[model samples]
Target: MKFLSSLVVLLLLFSCQPQKNASDYEADLIIYGGTSAAITAAVQAKKMGKTVIIVSPDTHLGGLSSGGLGYTDTGNKSVIGGLAREFYHRVYMHYQTDSAWKWQKKDEYGNKGQGTPAMDGENRTMWIFEPHVAEQVFEGFSKENELEIHRNEWLDRESGVTKENGKITQIKTLSGKTYSGKVFIDATYEGDLLAAAGVSYHVGRESNATYGEKWNGVQVGVFQHKHYFNVNISPYVIADDPASGLLPEISTNPPGENGEGDKRLQAYNYRMALSRHPDNRVPFAKPENYDPARYELLARVYAAGRDDTFEKYDPIPNLKTDTNNHGPFSTDYIGKNYAYPEASYEERKDILQEHIDYQKGLMYYLANDPKVPAEVREEMAQWGLAKDEFTDNGNWPHQIYVREARRMIGAYVMTEHDVLGAKTVPEPVGMGSYSLDSHNAQRFVTAEGFVQNEGDIGVHPENPYSISYGTLVPKKEECTNLIVPVCVSSSHTAFGSIRMEPVFMILGQSAAAAASLAIDQGIPVQELSYADLKVVLDEEKQILTQEK
Candidate 1:
């Protein structure tokens, strides 16, 4: 009887050792994002004959590509080669068929139809499309590659799992499921994976003295755009009267010492998705806490007969517009999102909803309020929420424009010298040509007591500049096993141009290629020779030089 009992215990112990099933868990690469870059990286990994999976926190596949802002910012489109170009090509293909335009007829819409290719096949530049069409193109890529995707899987960012040698052995989700992989790419805008891996990163603006950059922080005297007070607009109940109580949105803090540093972050607002389709349009509804007093400054502007209030509704596709924050007081929820960078998920959610309410309420006020100028109200009424888009979230954008977030202090720190055409980089992975664009950082009382905005830089890049691989790699001591394509280390000004979506896609593909090569060559990603990486990038059709 004792011998039989020991035999049973041995059988159970042998069965308890978990066997690796062929289908249960396995992959050559695991990507942690659902942004456009994340999709491109996963697709590239699969194309290279590696098994890959995308674990995204978003329910949707494409990030801002589908989340409105479809009016692409493709500066130096020729530099956008590789998978990024393929994405636009696919968008062109989608519109080639007449059926793609179901709502509007091809002849009626003419050459300017929805999802139509803005790029001449030979020109190598395209920068316009519909939101749904961008989503469809991303979907097509996923389907053609047959990539495995798990959406809405938030990473257990704090102490969930790790290996002894700084490798991410397993990443558990909020639901307690674990995903293990040999190689990982953090394509997220937040750099959550990279931060969790103990990588050094920075939130808010960095001091100019830290990097010797001209446009690093506290840009008080530099007003390059018309976003601030061209003419004094009062924030008080009585125009130019200081004793009538302070204005609702104006910040009381003194604009920090010029060229000095502060913790102020660039403003964030929803890139509203609106359409003219009468059947599909949901007219802006008055928000629950709609206060007419919140828009008193706007009314003051209108009362002063500023006719340019509606000029900011930039066009997108199919009679839609990617409306942005324009003028002194617009869609930007000033002073409300200072803590968004390191905020928890629940806190972030609250911030997002607050922005939604503020923006929606602003629209409702413009369209319905009798106090608004007749011309402004008429123009506002013409535009409404795009009835067919973002069906899940009530026709509003799902993602907030996180303009600047936790920037990884990586191997290569790109500074103003690179963007100002003063110095050239030795190793180039991609190129950025957009101006050093940053929206307002704070709204303050001007010298004369009227409220004004500061920190809006639109300086053009002196020339097309190259992005280095060092910008993607972390310090060896920080984390050797991670690659960060998004949230790369750079001077605040340089990052402005590199933050575009197409550039992110280009970097994503390049990061994946480097990761695969590192795995094959048995070396850390930082140790891989640039010559070899350049060869693969060139062969893969990635544009490395402006002259090319």
Candidate 2:
């Protein structure tokens, strides 16, 4: 009897181990990318009683949310609820402990965050935190939910995705690992998996007429940020000597007419984590390929008596600031990132290295160069990269902020009208209240012989508007069991508003819930009832409608 009982137990234990599919590992759901949305989606899948795995190319998880963008770009806190809000609440919980404030006392850090109370005593949500704290919180989410993430796994774009009957059956990574699932979610910033799976997507700006948007395409006359050259700065390499040709960063082509369509994308930069604390700062080191000549324009701008470089040095916890591109000729490598959207991996690496060199050189120039003003140089010398952040990349940010990438053109593309709350979204999965914001796309010489920056716009939406469920799923004919949360379907102008980190998290949870429901009903993701999805989301505390 004892031998028979042992045999039965051994058979059951072997059966419980996951049986590998002929293709790769099999699960109920497979998630791609390592963005914050990707993490949240995997967690939601785990909660929905599904076996899920994350196959990501990123060495570090939580894209910009953990990559030195500590100052939350939260438009309205009320609209952020559910697991997204839970994330912020967890950030608060981490700081509530006495030991969490290592460098500074919690009482002294008086950051009434985003013009509102950063510490909501009632809601227990913290709007502001450090990069490492945010990353730790996200990692905790992964551990508590038993979420499996296979980092550093790149998807082979060419022959990776295996589809059958208009659905992704299995996906192969460059490392030869494969994942088969009943449902899939593409949460990447680049929409690599979506495009590989044959889903239609759009890159760069669309014409205003294409979506009846006032701020969709090449914006020449409209200027919102202080990133434009104010004075009449000459565009020539030798400062008004036309025969010497244009400067290194300035483009020779025309910026095109207003409202014209173009393939140019917004500038990309690293959201730096600079610290004033001496113990926690690593002084800026010049890159191996640093060229001081690259910053000639910024020097000229400073020479013209523009000292607003410190305007965007917004402070976060532990005496660190989320240093962003402030003035014209700042760290925004304009017109250089146009090829990034469709560039090959090698080409993309080159582009990313260029940005890093440019930004790092900018810091060294501001701190140590003789051309910088003495007072400004002295002030900048006090700031350096935070010692405890992004240690894998020499204390710099691991991820460059890819503000916009390939947006899927799914069954319903949310337009500017939807952004401005002029039209109603059919099914409410999330809400975005941030401004329709895009950084400069191209920097060129105007007809007046002055260097100017183009493609920056900031139009505030009227209220927190709902995001649609259709935007998450592809067209019924395109794919049946896939959902895209990060690279959602929307026009360029509308995506500007919908691309906030909080909104991405909200959409991630909603997409996972939809995926679970589709699996339960044994139907396509697009065929899953929005009414049923809403009930699940509501139970999970997702604020589909705007909060009062």
Candidate 3:
């Protein structure tokens, strides 16, 4: 009788305690990353009558779109199609209302540089906007389509992502919750999901020799911007001083046998939220472990009458500026983030905090440091965190603009020739037109002892060009079931142009559509015919080609 009671109690306790290893949820498609691409994918899946869920590590929905990249870098707006176009259209709708501009009137805002408005009665694309408004638009999409979202869910990449016969079976989160899906899309900027799934990817720049391409690796002789102004003034203690212990930020290695590539990666920084509203603004706080010597070069630059240093603090909608790192020794924490692409989560968190500290410290140095020019300090003091934005995280941006990361080694790689109109892709799904722009990846002193920044390209595409569908798919042997819309296969130069938020959203929708079709046809994603894919894309109003 005692044994019988004990067994019964154990069985009842197990039943009521929740199934230990059972999956609590299932979806037709599971997308990792809460980027603009991830949201678009979820919405597209819903439109296709398939169940989908977005599991994002970020608490916010849209990545950089809602982060602080309010000034859009769209190359050719006409080529943007499908849900990507719809997102911008929704932005237009939001601004169409008289109440949209609570702080400023429409005429007062004026059409500064966003080109002529769209003629179809929609307020032409307001490429620039406040971060909160963009977030509302993404949230609106989720509400309208009833998207299932689990924010702040980081994927366990190693043993967490399970596969069977080249298809993803389930993905486990760091919190021990498991999500099962029929198909998966890695809509993350870092390509964490794809990497965890054992997909082949490349980090850093591929040498020009490897791809037979013009611009791939360390470009030494190219001086594009005034970033390295007066490179003669060394950051070290003594002029031409290798003995003064290498300038604080300058790399020590030879700049890699000129066209030969190394594992160096581009700098990453937060798109800080700043406001002129005195009531809501918090002055830039001096970071802990602050060192004044690190900014000595900047002080010298300003003292040399470099008054145009503040020119790149470009204004956005809410009386805030999307201040980016310009000039040498600016906001970019040069040479501190080489391992970010593949670092563990805890390590990434440390990297992010370090970047935050660096940027904040830079702002503080500019605004309050006695060494800064009075005029520059006063101007810098006028800006602070916007009172009405990013309320949950103390008014700082939640997402760091990860400009470049892992580029998948997939079936097709988009190259500069494709973007420059020198070549055309047959399996077109989307298009991009942003200038071939790459931020300085490394800072080094020339043999003549002049400071120089390499890997900054700003060439405009010959015209708008098609983005091939093949760029989004992995090889069949690697992962037949996965599609990477965010970190698609592309040359480092080509990705610079394709890395815009709108383009990512457009690609996300197209990838989801392909995934749905593949599931319906019982075929691998790579095996889906372009004819069938094109038909669906057309029916859904995805702009695939330029007329004329």
Candidate 4:
């Protein structure tokens, strides 16, 4: 009797404890990352009548779209279709409601510069919106479709993925949860899932010679945007004194040869949601680790006649602005995020906090520091973080703008030729029309001893171009079951245009459609018939080609 009672108690205790290694949760399709791409992919999979799960690394969804990039960088809006268009349409519906406007009246907002009305009632699409509104739209998709979203679940990059015959079978998270799926989509900005699964990827810029392109590598003198120092400014702490050492944020190393390859990545920053509305604004508070001296270079830039601090404070609805990096010294923490793509989770956290601290300190320096010009300071003081946005994150953007990261070296590499409309793509998946825009990769002293930024390139494509479906799938031998959307195979230069949020959402839907078809046909994702894929993509209203 005593033995029997003990056995029953042990069994009860085992049952009560949660299964940490549970692989019981299986889906026909699994989408990773909490980006706009992830949301669209999951929705597309569900619409195709497949069981799908979104294993999201973020507590919040929609990545930069919901974070703070509300002022869309849409080069050509005509090509945006499918779920991507639906997302903007929902934004239109939200703004149509009179209750959506709180701090500003709808009629008072003048929509300009987008070549069309921001609120396009004819097409039922609104291109510009608030960060919170974007989040709400993404959340609505999840709620309406009854999608299974596992939030804050990070992929254990090391020893987490289980493979069989070069195909991913299961993935485990650091939180000890395992997920099994027939087809997987890596929709992260960082490409963590694809990298962890042993897919070939490239970081940093490749040489122009390697890709046979004009803008693939280092562009020492290229200054399309006003991010480079035009006036002669000494890089030393003391003007014209070499022994005085380099100023803060200026690199000491050489800027590298023109067209040469280097491991330097373009800058990244938070797309701030700030408002001038007094009742709805939170004053820019100095971070706990604030150091005003860190922005000495910026003060010097102001003294040297650079006064475009507020130029890129692009406005969104409700009197808010989706502020981005503008001039020579601004929000972009250039050359600081080189190691972020491959860094360990703990290291990445430290890097993330550093960015948060740097950006927060920048705001404080601009708004309150005595070194800033009086007029500029006064204008900056009027702009504060919107109280209604990112309420949980101290009124700051929750996601950092990871401009570029680990790009896959997959089946087809999209190059400058393709983006420039010089070469037509095969097996078209989606379209991209934005300019090839890359932020400064480094800040270094020029041969003439003046400080200048290098690697900022902005060359507009001749026209809207189609993206290859081959860009989304790995080589058949590497991983047959996985698909990558956000980090599609592309040269660094071409990725600049394809990296836009609308393009990402477009690719996401196409990737999910492919995943569903591959599962149904019992074939590898790489082997999916393009003709059949095109039929489904057409039915889903995905814009595949640019009709002149």
Candidate 5:
């Protein structure tokens, strides 16, 4: 992910002229964002005999896949096919080799993946791994495809996309470089490129009435996870006194009534890759601007006789884990990032740094602070950041798990009914079976003065259902040539299920296949026949139907 004077390359290509022709850097398909979806899109485009290039803003290749989300959120693996399933099959193959297992023995690791074998013998799939291992697998895929990736090239949000007659002909980067393409895919979690091209997208949650969904908007009463604080714990700065101002992370505003719409977003946390082994552990360092007062709510959680903590330090391979948010005040910095989806690059960077600093400080406080429970502090001291992982970025994950962001309101919107098997979708580009899992979107002080987490729901889909091809393309009139695989067209509730990493890669492959066919037949992606698109997807081994 190291930059190789690519900015200089872009600057020279533009020649400070402030403008360039379409022929400056041309490709048949240009994929934006350096996510894992972007990797598969470029690879699939190459397989379809199209010249592909990745205009990547990230130096790191994989998004959340390589960003310590190693304990993959795979639901009903039978529905997974194409590049998405193949990635896991390759992960299984890697574990079969001695060179792949460095810190743990295969037999010692045993076999434990969500109620199924960690290594599925019949399917040749692996569902658990380390962060570094996943990154290596993605890097191997990039090298095998021999794809061109322009790293650190950010999109110029203002006046970047060049369009003619309702189609995007080319896009310009911030460095003044232009990339012309017949088709473009926006695979970023933020959907920046899609938005820059004048594609209409929706931010925040839509009301249940908007999509007739069961769980779409404000969910103040539903409590699915243990993220809610104990009712006995007060939210004031001075335990029971409202006269003292609100605590550090507590919101003073009222949580809306259930089923109402709001601008809140799910809590974001680093999926820390922690190592328990002494050889690989890097002791959690106190971050700059450390503030013990920042974790006042966390101290209250411990003092309330709540001893059961650390339930979400999910294990991966090699004595490491994909550590995530646990209790009421663990790693999730609640109600902090509502503006990130629409923020400028500089503004977004500031937000991300704030999150990084907050998380880092939390780790330090847990291991060393006197206020944290002695039992929890002792357990926290046993784990530290992996010394071998994320070597360049101070052994921390580079990509924050952006669970949901600017979802495009395209030709068709996938809803909760689509996921729960009530609405039947005819155009199947891919399939998903994950639960409607949404973290607490807001943290507010209740009527009784106790802090409570709201908007956390975890309901499973009734059956494995197909994702519509319509979700990948914008409305025909907006921008016919651009495809969005990651930030799909879906209700916030449905996006909670479809936003998983596997589905992103599946959508990426399908996007490229459809793009290739559109170029061959001289048609817009929206006008491309579902029958024809299905043919290519089937040939590429995409699972279009549920297996018996």
Candidate 6:
């Protein structure tokens, strides 16, 4: 009788206490991505005294910034401010130490950059660095801020998002984990969370007419870059034979009207980090699906006397090169990633593997194939994947260069006129000055029976233009508390200029500021006053407009 009375008293005491769920996963701000923007956004949110959590689909942080694109595309570096500029300053500080330069001395690099010195002492910024160094800096930012990151957590796109009166209450991942937050920021390259949340976005190019833009649509003959085929190459398997089928990778469909819209996406590739130093180089291994016939057109390109294979082997800090797409058939896998934006996770993995196989096979063929020119092959043979970078991913970059993806149709759509500074941007939050640079969308057989690359446009903006705060805000009716920075509201032409790593970081910080302010004032992101947002942004040292 005594033991039963004690047990009943214990049960009653436990029931009266508050229940705590270990799996609650609640926070003040929830950021979805592992890009450079994600890092900056989380840092800004945490700085504003918000309990923030980063749910990243990527195993590695820093996106392309650490994934072999160490050569920063910084236009008018003076306009770069806030956390974005701080990131570059951190790179400069890292290189100042003797231990940072392992393979080569700092003096040998000669401070080469995109029309500016790679390492500027006066400005205290470094524009070029190694992939591992970039990753270290980004990781340092997270560690210093004590930010919590859940890596490799992919969103369950089908039914993960739970909305209460147009605002996201919480999101669930594929692992059956749920995260609740007052505000959410989608900073992914693919805009995965934004799309899963039923936000309206565009998948491909908007017609010039759709946005009153000059460089938005099908650019069949506008070959501004060296990516187009300079020499006339026949598209048929048997040269000039109509009955013969088209060559591999050459689309049979028409290249489309000059300025009309299409669902084509720009090329995608891994910005390879290669080293010629024998001690740190790993030879390119042939892929399991290697086919010599796949590169027959490349051999033909060699026959046409184009030896510009190493044109874009831009040097970085540690005797390594950030090798990007150069010639007509170098690296950008044209016409291959059209479905990546809207693809399921499993389907996207398959597409990613295909791209990996294609690029890996290309490197092996270029270095080993007898059909390639002896000089070209010998030069290529000297270069191989960097042994020290991407240590976990077989020395290959983990993140593929996703130049463009789903762009949100949000509070305001930035068009070409805005990018060119013809129409003034209202409520400025950041600035971008890079040219409208788009890679080829298709390698198709032209009407003249010649193979040609289309949809490569490079139109420079007249001046550094301000980006409006509206670009980051979703339509109030769609979702009030959500903010998107990486895939902001912009047309294809405008995105070309805004899609830089520095610009993404800038907008990310701005987004978090708006989110923090909205949460504090109990207002939607769209309804937050620009005056209040600008005051905070100015205090944070963000360059919102061109300085007089």
Best by TM-score: 6
Q: What are the models' TM-scores?
A: 0.93, 0.95, 0.93, 0.96, 0.95, 0.97
lDDT of candidate 2 vs native? Answer: 0.88
Clashes of each: 0, 0, 3, 0, 0, 0
* Top-lDDT candidate index: 4
Worst 10 residues of 5 by lDDT: 15-24
* lDDT accuracy of residue 217 in candidate 1: 83
Better of 4 and 5 by TM-score: 4
Taking the tens digit of each residue's C-alpha lDDT, what string does model 6 give over 75-115?
88888999999999999999999999888987887678997
Q: Model 3 shows how many backbone clashes? A: 3
How high a TM-score does candidate 2 get? 0.95
lDDT-superior candidate, 2 or 6: 6
> How well is each residue in 1-548 modelled by candidate 2, as lDDT tens digits?
99999999999999999887664788899999999999889999899899999998998878899998888889988889888999999998988999987778889887667857777778889888888888998899999998888899988899999999998999999889999999999998899999999999999999888988899888886878788988988878888888998878988788888887888888899999998989998998978888888788888898888998798888887788888888888878888888887787889999999999888998998998988889889999899999988888899999998988899999789988987888888998988899998999999888888888999889998788889999998999999989999999999888888888989999999899999889889999988778899899989988887733
How many Å off is the CA of 487 in candidate 3?
A: 0.7
What lDDT score belongs to each candidate, Candidate 1 first?
Answer: 0.80, 0.88, 0.83, 0.93, 0.88, 0.92
- Residues 303-373 of candidate 4 have per-residue lDDT tens digits of 98888899899889889999999888889998999999999999999999999999999999999988899
Error of 4 at 236 (Å): 1.1
Q: What is the lDDT of residue 276 in candidate 2?
A: 90
Q: RMSD in angstroms, candidate 1?
A: 3.3
Candidate 4: where are CA atoms >4 Å away? Answer: 1-23
lDDT of 1 by residue, 314-366 (tens): 66556677778888778888777788878888988998888888888999998
Off by over 4 Å in 6: 1-20
Clashing pairs for predicted structure model 6, backbone only: none
Pairs that clash in candidate 1: none
